[model samples]
Target: MWCRIRRRTALPRKLKTVPTTTAPNSFPCSTAANCGKKVLDYAFQRGLMHPEDMGPMTHWYSPTPRVFLEHFKPEFMVQSSNNYDHPEQQVWDCDDEKNVEHYMELTRAHIKHYGKGELFHMIGLAEWVFGSPEENLATKIRVMKTFIRHLRREYPDAPLLIASWDFMFRWKAPEVRKLLAELDPADTVILDYTTDSGSYSNNFVNWNLPHHFPWIFGIFQAYEPQNDLFFNFDRAEEMYIPVQDDPMCRGMVIWSENSHSNPLLEYLAKRSVDEPFSLGQFCANHCGDRAAAMEGLWEIRINFSIFFRKST
Candidate 1:
C-alpha cells in the first residue's frame, strides 16, 4: 500500500542546527552564473551564516570538473562524438567495448575519493547522463544501471541521487520507474523537479514506485535573463505542508538557473530548517507586501514571455 500523509496533520517542528563550516553541506549547486561563493555570500549577508565561524564540511560526490564524461581518459574522447558547443549532442556510445574499461576506471577513482560515507550528503548524476540526447532510452537505461551498480558496489553506504526533468517522466515514466526499481532504495534518491506548472505530488504518487524510494522535491524558484521567480509561493505554502509530512519526502531543494541567491530562495531555506515554521510568518518576516507585488509582476512577465514565444 502507498503511504500518504494526511492533509490536516501538522508538519514536524524540528530543525537540525547548522554546523559551523567553510561551506554548508546544503548549498546551491553551481550553475551558469551562480557559483558557490556567490551563494555563500547571499546566505551570509542575509544573516543565515557567518563564514568566519565555519569549518570544513564533508565532501559530496560531484563529478570533478563538472564536465560530461571528462573524467574518462583523453583516448576515450576520440571514441565518441564531441560537440563542445552543444551539450545535448555530446553523448558517446554506451555500448562501445572501449567504454567499459573507462567506466570501471572512472568508478574506481570516484570510489577512491568519495567512497563509503565520505560524501556529506548525496552524489549527483544528473549532468552525467539524464538529459543527454546521445543515447536511446534502452541504452540510457543500461548505462545508468551499470553506473549505479558500480557505484553501489564500491561505496555501499553513500547515498546516490539522480535528477530528472519533467519531460522524462511525462514521456517515459514506465521505463524510468523500472530503472529506479532496479536500484537499492536505501542508497538511491530521486531529485525530481518541474520547470513549468507541475507538482511534486503528481510525480511522487503517479509514478507509483515503491513507497520506500527516497525523494527530494525540487522547485525551480528562479531563472535567468529576467532573473524572475517562477514558483507560486502561495501554492507552495499550501502544498509543502503535506509534502513535508510524507516519510518518503526527504526535503526540498530550491533551484535557480543562473542565480541561486534570491530573496525567495533565502526565505525557503530558512523555512526548511526552522522549527514551528509558518508560511504566513515567513512572508511577514520578509516583506509580504513587496513579495506579493513582485510576484504579480513576475506573473505578467512570465505569461507574456510564454505567449510571445508560442506566437513567434
Candidate 2:
C-alpha cells in the first residue's frame, strides 16, 4: 500500500505512482517521522525557527500533530483539529455519542500536552460542516464548543480562529454570526484565508465587514498543484498599509496551501509590517537595471494563474 500527501490534496502527477512501504494513511512513514523529529530537535537545540514552523496542516489533529507539541514546541502553533478533519468513520458524522466524547478527549489531551498558556491559536474549517448535511450542524457546533472549552480552560489567552474558507465556500454572515454568539469578542478571531486568490475573489466572507469583528488578514498566493508564483504585489501594498491602522485587524498570516512557494510575497508580507513594501525599491536593490523588466515579470505572473485554472 502507499500514502501520498501534498498541498491540501494529493501528489503531483509525475510523483503519484511512487511506492511506499507503509500502507494507506500512514501519515509519517519512517523517513517522514524521522525528519519531523530531527527538525524539532534542531529547533529546540538551536533556539531557531521559521514563521511557517508554527503548526501542522489544516486537518492535522491526528496524533501526527501531537508530535509538534510534544517535541517541536515552537513559540506558536495553529490547532486545526476537528471532527470533520478527524481520521475516522464518524468524521463527517461527529454527533455520534462516542465520537463526541472522543473528540473532546483528544482536545483535552493536546491542550494538556502543550501545558497551559497561549502556545496555540486554534483554526476551524467551518465549511467542513456547513458543506455537509445541515442536520448534523448541532453536533458539529457541539464539537467546536467542547474543543474551545478545553482549549480556553488550558490556554486562556489563546483565540479560536474561524478560518476564511467558512465564508469562501457556502457559509456566510448569518451562519457565522450564529456561531459567534457563542464566543467572546476578545477570545474570538478570524482567519481571512485567501485575500489574493480569484478563487475567493467574490467570496461573501470578506464582504460586509463587521467592524467589531477582529481578524487576521491572509495571503494565499498559490495552492498545491499550481505552486507557480501568481502573487499580487500591488494589491498587497494597497491592503497592507491601511490595515496597519485598523484596530480590529489583529495580525497577518501566510495562508498558502504550500509554504515557501512565493518567498518574495512572504518577505514582503513580513517587511511591510514595519513599513509599506515598495516593489520599485525592492527591484532596484535586488534586480538593478532589470526593475522595469521585473515589474513586467510580476504582471505576467499575476496573469499566469488563469492558465493553471484552465489546465486544472
Candidate 3:
C-alpha cells in the first residue's frame, strides 16, 4: 500500500501559493555534536550567512531521550507545587490528558523562549513524539492535534514546523492522512526525508496531502563514529535540483550526527546561501579548480568507503 504512494505523480511545479511568512533557508545542526558553534563560526567566516538563516538556532529532535522536553517541564508548569528540581526523574505519559497538558505548557514555554526575531516561532523537531511506546497512534495524533491547536492560539503568527520521516508511507496505522489534512497549511511546515534515504528523491514529499502545506527537504550528511558512508554529492545534486527549483519547497536542512563534516557542511552551506545545485561553484570555491574539486570529492568518497570497510 505504501509502495503505491511512491508511485504517485510528483507535485506540480506551480504549487499553491505559499504564505509570505515562510522561512527561506535553514541549516540544521541539531544532530551534530558540539559543532553548532563551529558551524556558526564557519558560516560567519565565509560571509555565507543571511539575516534570515535559522541554522544557528534550529533544534534537532527525535522521540526517545527527550532531554529538551523533559527539562522544560518544571520551568513551564503553572502550578508552583508541580515544579521538580530533577526534571529527569519525571516521567511524562502521553496517553494521559493531564500529562499531555503539561507537555503543551512546556511547548508554550519553549516557544516563548526561542520564538522571536525574524522567524517568530521556535522550530520544533517533533516526529518521534507523535508515536512512541507510551502512546498509541490515536492518542499520539490526538495529542499532536491538540498541541498544535494550543500553539496556534498562543502564537498565531509563528510558523509551526513539524518534523517527520516518510509520514505518508510510514504513518498508515490508524490513518493520520485525515488528521493531517485538517491542519492549516499556512502555518504548518513539514520537514521530510533523512540521510538514510539518500536525501531528497522524487517521492520525498507526500503528494497525497494538501498542496499548500510548506515542505522542507532534509539532507542528512554525516553521523557519529565517523562512518565512511555519507551523502553522495553527485546523487545529492540530482535529487535536490528539482527541489531547489520547486515552488512548494520552503528550503532544505543540512544535518550531521556528532561532529562537523567539512565536505557535507560546505556542500549545504553553498547550496543554501551561495547557489542551488551549484556543484561546480562549490568545488571551485573549496578546491580552487574544477579538476582539483573533482579529485577532492573522489578522495572523500574513497576515504569514506575505506573507513566503513575496515570498521565492518
Candidate 4:
C-alpha cells in the first residue's frame, strides 16, 4: 500500500484503488497497489497497509461518529491514557462501563465502514494506554484483554494487529511479555513497527527483543514531525535478509508519518523480501545513467533512517 497523508493520492500516480470484492456493501480496495496479495477474498487474510487508514479512512470518514458524538468532540491526545495530558483532560478510562461501550461502538463502526478495504484487513488501536503515574497495571491489562475478547467475539474476520508502542515505554519488558502471552495468538498479529530503529529504547532494546508470536516485520521510518532524508540501501541485506530467514516472521509492513517520500527505497523494502538487494542492479533498474552516483550516495555507513524535518 502506498500510504501518504493528503486528501488526494500520491505523485506520478503509482497507486490506483482497484475494487477487489464483487459482494454487496464491500469497499473498493487496492491489495498492494504498488507493492504486490490475497486478491479479493477478505477472509483470505494476507494484505499490506499502514495504521494511518485508521485515522483518515476508518475513524474520521464514518458518519457513525457524528451520530453519537454530535459535535462535542473530546480532544485526542498523542497517547490515550486514563488521566494525563494537556489542553484536554479526556481520559480513555476502560474501567468505566460507559466508556467501554462507547469505545466498542466506535471500534465496530471503524470495521464496518472500512473492513472490506483489505488494507483495513487487520484492526489495530494505534494509541492504547499510556500508563499514567497512578496506573494499576493488573486492572488495566484485564480491562484491555476483556475489551479485546469482546472484539474477538464480534469481529472475527481479521487478526488484531497489536502495536508494540502500546506498552513499550509505559511498562517493563516482562510485563509487556505477559500481556502478549495471554492474548489469543490465533487471533492476534503483532506489528513490532519499529523493528529497524530501536531508538525508542535506552540502547537498541526493542520492546519485543525475543518475540515468539505471529509477528510481522516493520520499518517505521517517520514520526509526527517527520525527519530528513537519509535512506540506507544496505538494509536490503542487513534488515530484510534475516527476516526472510526467520520462522516467526509472517510478512512485512512499512510505516511512516507521511504517505511515502522515497519510492525506490520503499519498493526495495518489499522487493528485498523475495530476492536479495543489489545496489548496482537496483540503481541500474531505476536511475538509468545515474546508477553509479546513486549507489555511491547511498553507500554511506549509517543505520536505517530517512528523517525529513517539517519546516517551522
User: Per-residue CA lDDT of candidate 3, range 270-295, in tens?
Assistant: 77774554445555666664657575
Worst 10 residues of 3 by lDDT: 1-10
Q: Which stretches in model 4 have alpha-carbon errors above 4 Å? A: 1-89, 112-140, 156-158, 167-172, 200-211, 223-229, 263-273, 299-312
Residue 159 lDDT (model 4): 60
Model 3 CA lDDT for position 113: 29
- What lDDT score goes with residue 14 in model 2? 32
For candidate 1, the 10 contiguous residues with the lowest summed lDDT are 50-59
Please provide, for model 2 over 1-312, each residue's C-alpha lDDT reduced to its tens digit, 9 standing for 90 to 100.
001121212222333344434446656444664554455456547754321111223343333333223342323221233444333211323334443343344334333322233333444434354334453344445666766666566567765565566465655556556666676778777667566655534432445333556777777665553354455667665555556666788766665556645555545465545754555666676778888898677667767756766687
lDDT of 3 at 272: 78
Q: Which portions of model 1 show Cα errors greater than 4 Å?
A: 1-89, 107-135, 166-170, 195-202, 209-212, 238-242, 273-312
Candidate 1 per-residue lDDT, tens place, 216-260, comes to: 766654455335344345545555555655678776775565553
Of the two candidates 1 and 2, the one with more favorable lDDT, higher being better, is 2
Task: Give the Cα-based TM-score of candidate 3 against the true structure.
Answer: 0.53
Question: Which candidate, 3 or 4, has the higher TM-score?
Answer: 4
Candidates in order, TM-scores: namely 0.55, 0.61, 0.53, 0.58
Q: Rank the candidates by TM-score, best first.
A: 2, 4, 1, 3
* Each candidate: RMSD: 13.3, 10.2, 14.3, 10.1
Clash pairs of candidate 1? 21-54, 21-55, 22-55
Q: How big is the positional error of residue 24 in model 1, measured in Å on the Cα after superposition? A: 34
Q: Which one is best on TM-score?
A: 2
In order, how many clashes per candidate?
A: 3, 0, 1, 8
